[model samples]
Target: MNIKKHAVITTVIFALNAPVWAGEASFIAELASTTLPQQAPVVASISTSNTYFMTSAPFSANSSAAITHQPQPDPAITLPQLIEKDWWGALAEITVVLVIGELLYKTGEESMKEDFDYEIEGNTGRYFVDRIVTTESWKLDDNEVGMNWGHAYAGALYHQAFRNYNFNYYESMLGNFLTSGIWEVFAEYKEVVSINDQIVTTFGGSVLGESFFQLSEMLDTKEGWVPATFAGVFNPSKTLRGWFSDDTANRFDRQQSTDQFDIYTGALYSTKDTADISTTTMLLGVKASIDSVQGQYDALSATPSLVELDMELGISAEGIEDWQLSSSLFLGGYTQEVKPTTGSRESWGHNWFIGPSMGIEYSSLGQEDEEDFFAAINVIGLSAGGEWQNADFNISVRGDIFGDFSMVKPFASKDYQASGGQFWGTKSVLWEGGYAYGLGHTAKLTLKQATENCY
Candidate 1:
């Protein structure tokens, strides 16, 4: 068994959300929920990045640099404030993007040049009807990466359109529902609606989309150019239209949210390669999270309460070679907090939450001869993890364990479809979208660490 050690000297500055949930921890059984956007948060910054934060602020830590917030009530944002926006403009923005993408896909690609060559013996209406009739649960034609991760990225685009106009979560999802539905129903009129695309796009946009949109909001509440750029990258629509351009001051809910985010960058040395190709590389990562844990929560509701997304990219001298994206949304549940007994040694804040949750995680690394090693999608399952925090040095260690029914492709084999030929310069877009598909019941384990100024 070859051993690999990852040593990272990271400047985790932007969104402090290390792979592990921050000080937001309560008890495992009573821990996660969200606070609505009541009072808008205030922005503060320090050196390197936006490091200066007020004490008791959710973004602060026990150490001078890292801190946690205490829950409190503030103002209420009326529905009218949320609904007041140019909805039509947002819709058009989304439509234009989808239309152009599909048009280019069908008209531009050589393989898709025969895009409308459907097997129909009738006119357009009949072809449309028959196309709908023949659509299955999923379209197998698209590569696994596109279905699993790419569609979701596309979905985030739809979710952000409405969010840019100041739309709330459910409303943004409404937009996602409508936009993705249209794409399935008419956007790519010639090709049959891709059921998998519809589901992945909609759901991924709902979870990932909202996460990034809120991430934009979170970053906006901070004072710095670096955080500002990230805010734009996550929600380009809002960025293009000029951020917070109106009276909508309630976008960043610092008053009610129990979220803390930070940018992560590091280095790793590892030798677990099945093909004996040990490697070392630098890392850069960011996180999108909101209300992951709090004082009170109700799991009985179907609305989404918590969204936690963590990503880590490995960069070798050759370029980015490995990465991981893990996201989870609390379907619903309640929170239980065991506050530090009046004046105890600050070690008594215990909280926990139990509720339904849905998530998607994809990790691609290592290589077995000519084929690559991959793990993608945990369709349905439960995961448990633990975290440790230190107050003096402002250090945190987080570990994640996953077990579930998954859709995975084990390796490069003649048995499945080819998935890695599309190229972008020296690398391949095929790497972005991995190889074939298969089913398996698998389990995985991952560990990560973060500190105030560790490199």
Candidate 2:
């Protein structure tokens, strides 16, 4: 093995070496309310509502109140899972990703400036062997575009396409694996297949993709020009295809019932040294939490128990200086509800939650070149929290600590002055770029309080 020795360790870094300033932690205070779903709570599920605050960017000060429902069990109520499929949409989208994507990519100047002669020597079978199981192996790609949100976004599109075709979550994921393999082997035949891309594209895409898919479904239930525009933006290809479905163009037939939906907006005024901005940033956010998760526990279906998204876009004189978005999907976990006792009746009630979660965070706070490592995919993590609800007011708290993975700029790179992603990405992608794949961690602390006069 012509293995070389270098000071930089390509393995995971389990230290707090992040560039975020500790003092830059933004204060969070919001006044919010949760509107319960119209339909009764499903069996095996409890009625729940909450609003949480976090010590993150886009700080605000407001009060909140949530009308919550207590837990109840129904032994007789049992529902069967529904399964659907649309093979044509999924198959066609895959074709677009490969055939059309390749065509468009070739038009770019950077993509045309390529080298490394690759061809099918000997026979086609031997070529397949060398590419898949032999010489043409996998390597960590060093490109900034494909390594971060780009490939994951592509994967998200694939996941939504499969889901829109009525494929369950696991089925969509299975399709994702197949789609990625096909793209790596068939689409980009010139370069060696990326082993990291295989994993990141499949799993990271699924986490990010499933979150967007569920949120898109939630938005589809709304009625307004704003909701429709946001929905179409979030799921563009799916929306366009839905309109042209069978050439019918029926826009209202895709509505799906959701358990809860809450939307809030705030304006954050930043001082100096706190953030990259000095002006006020308008903030808007939406959150959804569903209890009765449809389908079976086999996890082969496309329904997540709890899906919530928090996104903030900072618009100032610089025209959107900071943009941050985070999405979380709670797959599964065990909960032991400890009802309030005589001694702990005031604050501690039969209200608590703990579970494993999958999520993705895309943050471009300052400039792309200044802080590019903020976006990290939470491969897998744990989330646990509880609430204190009374007739007059409510207070809920949640804290999350997650291990993250991302394509971080190398601590030291040979090409320090490369401008734009193309400079370090083009010509060479495996090890010649300013960034490389690595692992990190993030911790969030949330607390929300409210006072309401409700009967």
Each model's RMSD to truth, in Å?
12.1, 11.7
Off by over 4 Å in 1: 1-80, 83-90, 114-121, 133-138, 144-148, 165-171, 295-303, 367-407, 412-434, 439-455
Pick the TM-score winner: 2
Q: Give all TM-scores, in the order shown.
A: 0.66, 0.67
Each candidate: what lDDT? 0.51, 0.53
Highest-lDDT candidate: 2
Q: Residue 375 CA error for candidate 2 (Å)?
A: 2.0
* lDDT of each residue in 1-455, candidate 2, tens digit only: 13222211221111111101111110000000012222222122211122111111111112131222333331111122122245786788777766766777667636534533466667887776677655335655545544446777777777776866655555565667668777877667766676557656665677767776765656776687766776776677767877866542221112122345566778888665633435577776666544322221212112455667777776766576677777777654443333333232253433455666677777765444444435677766777776665444557788777777765554333235553234433435424654555567777789988775331
Model 1 residue 268 lDDT? 87
Which 10 consecutive positions of candidate 1 have the poorest summed lDDT?
A: 6-15
Which pairs clash in the backbone of model 2? 30-62, 31-62, 31-63, 32-64, 86-165, 169-301, 169-302
Q: Model 2 lDDT vs. the true structure?
A: 0.53
